[model samples]
Target: MAETVGDYVLQRLREWGVQQVFAYPGDGINGIVTAFGRAGDDPHFIQARHEEMSAFQAVGYAKFSGRVGVCMATSGPGAIHLLNGLYDAKLDHVPVVAIVGQTERSAMGGAYQQEVDLQALFKDVAGDYLVEVNVPEQLPNAIDRAFRTAMSRRAPTAVIIPSDVQEEAYTPPAHAFKQVPSSPPGLTRPAAVPSAPDLRRAAEVINAGSRVAILVGQGARAAAAEVQQVAEATGAGVAKALLGKDVLSDDLPYVTGVIGLLGTRPSYELMRDCDTLLIVGSNFPYSQFLPEFGKARAVQIDLDGSMIGMRYPTEVNLVGDAAATLRALLPLLTGTPAKAWREKIEAGVAGWWRTMEQQSMVNADPVNPMRVVWELSERIPHDAIVTADSGSAANWYARLLRVRGEIRGSLSGTLASMGPAVPYAIGAKFAHPDRPAVAITGDGAMQMNGMAELLTIARYAHRWADPRCVVCVLHNNDLNQVTWELRAMGGAPKFEESQQLPDVSYADIARAMGLDAITVRSPDELGPAWDRALGAGRPTVIDVYCDPEVPPIPPHVTLEQASSRLRAVLKGDPGGLHLVVQGAKTKLREVLPGQDR
Candidate 1:
């Protein structure tokens, strides 16, 4: 049988060394589905419960594997469903290629069923690159460009294949004038370094300051050792952005945890007290958390020149790969390590961890959500890949969990979208089938999509070499994050119609789907539940009933936030009394004797 366009597409993907493609079936891609069957599932097709979940899984796979992720969908609704996750990949700077099927070319202009103007629809999300393959001759170059652009720009790109065109006989581009041919599949990455002058200037600024602070993001993942070397040389306190949570181990005494509203107190102080700031590979958006505008002489190192010097006023901007640039700068740095400053930062980090423990122990009606993550932190394997969905769950994951060893963690950092945790874990499993993957999610997100993805896990659980995929659901029957945001940010009381979630037994549902399930109502049960789930031979779900009234208090609360909370309580917030009690208890841990400034 002669090769078809769909067959050639898969062949190109194989040439690019793609191991899997996350997708869902639809009639719009009938040709491709048939081709997949004919190809014997080479570059395996990993079916997701939804197109959005497929895109997110691809993003997660790309994030963990350091390779371009690919997701496929059918026309119209399926393509539309992919936008949110594609946007998540775009915003978080993850490379993902979306292959979407379109209506038959003949029926496109006549508004055939499932026909949509996919180019206009995907223009923004896949702004880096978007193309429609109208003929078989466009195959190799179009698909190759999609993958190449997505990887080079670290953004989502798209390729639209018309249904009829997918069935056409494959044809290579001719050696004639108008045909475009692509080079063989493989990208060679260069280690970019800044100019000698910029490195010297950055080194000079670091050498001149008595108190130095360094901030890192996901971009710093490859440069962890170099970051530590710089910290030792300059006696700088290192703080991570949420996306860079796993870049450095929390066990490092001088490593202040995440820096932002959900960041550690030591991180806040590290930014506030520093005389000089060094931002490496992090585009952390919260400028208010950094040192006052003119107080600190700042230097930034990033691979993208467009992003440099935008967040803060920097004395020197070095556009280069983080590890290579830092390696170059190391020899130029002549700073004397400030023992006193390093000691103070270490002391603050120690106190902050103590405060986190105290906060986790605070009483709640059922379980303090913080305690759930704290317990997991105690038992999570060294090589586990942990994912957290957005909401109050992120607060606990950010503050309570400590990442060490080869552990990798990420979320919708820039987009802050919910429902990616479970899918991300699914993608992580594909990325590393030998390692255990865990997802921390809230009830709202679990109901939104996490629950459906459990079936996907159950379906694929048998394929994993180490089948310990655990989804820990914070079963608080409330949209807890937005509920707190309404009170703290808008001074509005919790509107139950929108804030309250209908309770569902996630564990029961998981068991029904042929996976291990554990339910925890008491704080003491959390540790044992986690152990069982982690040791389980298959996928597991731990549904812990959490306190909806527990507030995710920020490290540094402003008077305005306090006033808003007070106004919310006075304005008849439903959980007013319980909210006050929990908030006060959670915050009290910070001022305790052992948690000294």
Candidate 2:
């Protein structure tokens, strides 16, 4: 007469397009674990040793399949461990459902065993959270909300499932719940563009400006064609925010390059030289690169009303979607392509490509960041989903690795956290088992994240990309980059401790977990190691001993930030002191390498 809670959840998940649930079991979730075992078929159960990896695995799976990724963990520290990975999903806009088993409702408040304020802890990171503590029927809507939120916002959603209730029996629905939609998404566009006055002002600025540039962001992904048209017709050039890289063809004539610290010089110079800059989509974070207030006129079009003037000031704030806004701007422009200025932007773009070709060939003895990621881009299948960790890893990936369209990817576009890559890779793999998935992680990222997720890869061990997924550990094994930043900011400790992390032999860790693993000592060994990883498929671990100091932040970063973080360290704030001595900031880029070129 009574059905267990796990069955109820699993049964509903199947109807919702969630085929599997990844999680690490614990005493806290005994009932759910038992229920999962008894759930027969359909929504399969995945066992991950570490809670963090369970969430990571979900991220990887979600990327390709475009399905809802589900991962579970027991209450207390176990559930807490999943937060970092969840934050990753939230930041990258992955539609993930994290089912956390809470402490028995009775002992929850007092911390029965490993309990903490799980909801409060996760609040800052997740796009939203759902706590299901009551009637079983209520779960369907909560689940529905999680799925819908994830898709609409492209972020992670948390579902806290209490332990006592996990096994509680309930009637099964005669039919399954509605499936989650993953693709061919829609948007609500305003019937009209900005007011006539604003449009007139923007037009006047465009008319007066000889050299104009257009900067696009992640929101421009859907408006690629419209954006390209505007660029071509107006003699305007294109500069992209990091998330906008794949929005347009890399070789588009008017695209100079990405603009930011990881960005190329061409984009920067173009932005500086251009008289008017049109921001198609994005509240791009970096104001440093934006034209100084009085220097040049800038216009921004966005869907969110609150986004206007959130970061860089805008002369014209058009409240509309990117596609529609561009379409509106297209007709207003009477000027033919200004051949001279257009030629200038094109030259800069051509120079960047030329620079890329020249530097990619640089055979540095120790192996450079550019070569590592460039070669990786070349070696990995074009369709492979490349997930990246924060820090130097992002910079390396941003500059060297080329994303072949919106194949598959997950990264903290704004938050820029580490550790997400590993968990995201797991999620991506689960969502799309048929596609090759890989995660690029720096030593700092793995150190902060659960190393045990490597074990999760071996559990399903499905043959997708044969060695369908691989982890390339850029093993500088230290937070050297952060320490330098701290030191520069005048915060580094006088007696800087060698915060270098002990060499983590991921190969050994992977082998211990029954996964194929290899460690490359030099550039020469990298190819062979990759071949083994790729050739054998299944999940393989490739740990490469590369320099952590070789960051991807523009070399100008070496000049140091205006605030001397190191000088602050010398002033003796113990926590601050520890970070500086530990070289924490040095590892900030976990993905952004030092000398990417």
Q: Give stretches of model 1 more than 4 Å off.
A: 593-597
Best by TM-score: 1
Query: Against the true structure, what is each candidate's TM-score?
Result: 0.99, 0.81
Cα misplacement distance, residue 444 of candidate 2 (Å): 3.0
User: Which lDDT tens digits does candidate 2 get at residues 1-597?
Assistant: 477767767766777767788877887778778776777745777777678777777766765565667888887888887876677677656678887777777787774777777678667766465555544555566666777777655678877777777767764333456422222223333444677677777777776677888898876777889988878777998887886776676667677667788787777887777878888777688887877777788788876676676766677788877787677777777766789999988887776665554454444435555556767766767567778887777777677665565455546677676677877777677666677777888788777763667766776665344447788887776664565445555545423455567776888888888877888776777667766777775678787777543434452454455245545544763445444323333333232333432
lDDT of 1 by residue, 1-597 (tens): 899999999999999999899999898888899999999998899999999999999999999999999999999999999999999999999999999999999887997888899999999999899999998888799999998898888999999999899999999998879899989998877899988887888899999999999999999999999999999999999999999999999999999999898888899999999999999999999999988999999999999999889889999999998999999999998979999999999999998898888888888989999999999999999999999999999999888889999999999999999999999999999999999999999999999999999999999988899999999999989999999999999999999999988878999999999989999999989999999999887899999999998888888999999999999999999999999988988887877744422
Candidate 1 lDDT score relative to the true structure:
0.93
Clashing pairs in 1: none
lDDT (C-alpha) at residue 195 in model 2: 70
